[model samples]
Target: MRGKSSIEVSAKLKHSFLFPDEYLDWANETENNFYVESPLIYEVAFYNGIKALKPWETIEYIPVVLTEWKKVKLEIESKFEKRDAKGATLPMRVGIGLFLELLFWTNGQPVELNPIIPLESLKIKPVNITERFAFILARPNLFHSYKQLAELMVEMEKLYVKSIIVRK
Candidate 1:
């Protein structure tokens, strides 16, 4: 087995197009990928023409958040144990690598975040914002090819850009 398969991440992400009104409902059970389109889910969330949805930017899929399952309390062998024994699911928040599909060179520099902030900064915060999130900037068509996808990932790594903050 690999090292990560054995490790457990505590928290996971649940993305939304717009931040939800009730933080309570933020953790809906059903899948919330924008491609799913459930009011809450959003596919390609943009910010500014450049910042939120930059052109030629590529992103790597990273596990940034953990969807923590509700902890189950149990007793075994005369000892109390709390384990990931019940239904627990979450999204691993991801950081994207940036690059231009058209322009091969002129790789942009990353804004060094000395201490990264969980709350992603947006040019304009959605009307009702709560949790912050991110996404890729390419059109869906580009993802079809392995070579194109690989190029995106490679450039995404070089740029070191963060994802967008989505709301339900």
Candidate 2:
């Protein structure tokens, strides 16, 4: 019964887009349940600036390294390149969001930005908060053209590369 209930809850979460806070709350309630993996939701919360109530001390925390950054950059670049080659007109919002999500996972202190900034933007400017941390400033737009999104990704890559260099 417990396994079934947990599966249902997990399915619901996977199917619907919930705010980070909602996922955090669900994870907190089910953290002790072996059938439910709370750490995954905790990751989503952490990426969105909500610290988990109970840190996963037992779990190995793999901080993003230079190799990981390179992997992510190459993957994203390949995706966009393929899309461009196919002449697809798909919106780049999702790709941009993925970039930001990955950026937040980097080792650093969380930097707060104005709440007014739209989560998805054509141009996301990274403001270096510390030697290894940044807060993104997003210019509001309904959608991003391929060229604009590619440029933004390049800029973000430069910032991450600089931070990685400082960390080394």
Clashes of each: 29, 0
Candidate 2 lDDT over 100-165, as tens digits, reads 433443323221223422223322245432211211113212223334444555656676566657
Q: Which regions of candidate 1 are displaced past 4 Å?
A: 1-27, 30-41, 44-62, 65-144, 161-168
Listed per candidate, the RMSD to the true structure in angstroms reads: 19.1, 9.5
lDDT of 2: 0.36
Model 1: weakest 10-residue lDDT segment is 65-74
* Sequence-dependent TM-score of model 2: 0.36
Report the lDDT of model 2 for residue 7: 21
